[model samples]
Target: MSDRMRMMVVMCAVALLAGCAGGLGGGTYERAEARRAMTVDYGTVESVRQVQLEGTKTPVGTIAGAAVGGVAGSTIGGGSGRTIATVLGAVAGGVAGSAVEESATRKRGVEVTVKLDNGQLLAVVQEDEGEGFSPGERVRVVRDGRTTRVSR
Candidate 1:
């Protein structure tokens, strides 16, 4: 074969080999499902508490607002007036920053309850899902010291 034809054949062989190696780990994940005989229970929310979530201090809106307000305020006056303008601009920027932060930090409450199989209930408010239990669902309750894990 010519030099050009020989190079083309080699490249084609390499490409075919790469393609064959690409699909080696393509398979389905299988989990064994089995039923265990245990007690199933229910609960109710006794009280709800408002919580403030921990989040990033720097939100896009706060940064954008500060930038725009600073530019606008700094341009509003000349000389000493410009100094006053910048200070005022910083105050406005702070207010805008806080508003943005508060909105971002707003938290949602998850209701946690302890239920006995004999229809008793106790509720608590927590940021994390307590025992991974949802409303009106059957779960396997594993009890440890001051904590629980609800499994299906």
Candidate 2:
């Protein structure tokens, strides 16, 4: 394939990989969570701070990048030179792809330390969906068996 075509494929793959990312914010929910009973606790926000939510590390990004790189590298030269280029390109692309995916999916998060009505203190971190929290604000601590989130 032509260099342009190969580049287009790579771009498309990256886009698809990005689309695979889902929100980690308080408002977002997985399908399985629908109608499932959850526990809720009332609390006052004791402290609110900004944090970074790390990106996902999935095989999809590495594999897609390697494939795109191998195809692009194959067009570089003839015979043995092309083979070496493909191998090197794949390796580099895989690393680059992983980084790109992580950077692209990374999000700003908030760490909310709350003082529950029961006198217990707990902290929860979740994507900062722009609904800012402040100290002394009333919030709800929602919990499922697997996860927890602080919401207003």
Best by lDDT: 2
Task: Give the residue spans of candidate 1 off by over 4 A.
Answer: 1-68, 116-136, 139-152
> Candidate 1, residues 22-81: lDDT per residue as tens digits?
111102111321243334343443333444444334444454445445555676779899
What TM-score, over all chains together, does every model reach? 0.40, 0.93
* lDDT per residue (tens digit) for residues 1-152 in model 2: 78788888888887878786898898988899999999999999999899999998888788878878788778789889999999988888888877877888889999999999999999999999997999999999999879898888
Q: Lowest-scoring 10 consecutive residues by lDDT in candidate 2?
A: 12-21
Per-candidate RMSD, Å: 18.6, 1.5
What's the true lDDT of residue 70 in model 1? 59
Best by TM-score: 2
Clashing pairs for predicted structure model 2, backbone only: none
* Superposition error at 61 for model 2 (Å): 1.2
The reply for model 2, stretches above 4 Å from the true place, is 2-8
* lDDT comparing candidate 1 with the true structure: 0.47
